[model samples]
Target: MVREKNPNVLSVHSIIHRQALTAKTLPTKLTTQVFNLLAYLLDICYSLNLLNLNLQDGGSNTIYHRDAITTYTYKFQLWNRKIIACNYSCFPKLFGMLEEALIKQTDTTNKISNQLQHLTDEIKRYFPSLCYNDSYRLAMDPFTLTQMFYRKHCKTIAVIKTKYRSKFNIASGLRSALSSTQPRIENLCKNVQAHPSH
Candidate 1:
């Protein structure tokens, strides 16, 4: 009711639900892997429904059947790249696992591999600071990578500024701001300071 009263208010729904709706309405010209993946998800839903029906018919013990169903559901979720437990810090690792699974399902010189690479590139484009260094997953602090890369990019811009000092007021200005921010970032990530060259 409050949302109705306020035009600016909007309803936010679960991402999984949104994805499911979009998947259903995807154009028929989708690639082979995407088509198969959607079909596989539909099959999983059907199997789950069958499990529920069988349980209701008293075909077996409720606890054991439910446990088996839960296990299968988890496997399906992982297979579908829709893990509920995944968070921002763990996203790169999850993508790596999904890519590995995709690799197993198709050859390197296939459309599926190209699609996977495109998906990875898109993710990296959005989160370059976090996804740039795949080997830096020690802890779940995304800020560490963010600050480290921010400092690095600042230095890079500063170097470019030095090459064209007369026409580079913006880069010079950014370098000055970064100079003040770097120390605080260094203090926040002593581990990065220990291996700053990385």
Candidate 2:
């Protein structure tokens, strides 16, 4: 009905549903292992007198540590701020270091390995895998995200400058472009309608 009223309207599903699903289906056993790790870290924090560590702040106990750029609590609040304070491009390397630390602490224990495996599985389920021949690129890298932001910012600035310089030119250009493509679009539409399978 909405599409009938606005035939040109485009519909795209929100990405939040994926996030919600990822959060909802988090494995409890993995969470427990993470809690154990956090507890161990908390004990170390106490011993090292790192009173500024706020891991115990009031919120979900579930620690969602995938990478520095993607760490959060189960309530979806950003967690591990200190861990993300490194250079922006180093964000991808932070999780590897953390995993190494975890491994060093646990001496070939199946519990830690199982937890890490579950975490890996959950990450693969939620995020785009870093595999070749994969096409689903995500804007998760800080450096890449910054570059994209600046690129769009520059484009927006250019559009604004052009609009201020000559308002009619933009509309007239679009009109001409649309007029030039109208016949091709109509022909494509006709072909699709006639074939139904095309």
Which candidate has the highest lDDT of all? 1
TM-score of each: 0.22, 0.24
Stretches of candidate 2 above 4 Å error? Answer: 1-69, 72-110, 127-169, 172-198
TM-score result, candidate 2? 0.24
Q: Rate the local accuracy (lDDT) of all candidates.
A: 0.51, 0.44
Judge candidate 1 at residue 28 and give its lDDT.
43
Residues 1-198, candidate 1: write the lDDT tens digits: 977789898788899999888887876434434644554445445655876677677666634554455455444444334323321112343344445455333321243334434544554465345423434432345677677777778666666677668773565566665565545665667656354574
Candidate 1 C-alpha RMSD relative to the actual structure:
26.3
Q: After superposition, how far is residue 175 of candidate 1 from its true place, in Å?
A: 74
Top TM-score prediction, candidate number: 2
The sequence of per-residue lDDT tens digits that candidate 2 reaches over residues 58-85 is 5423222223213322212212222233
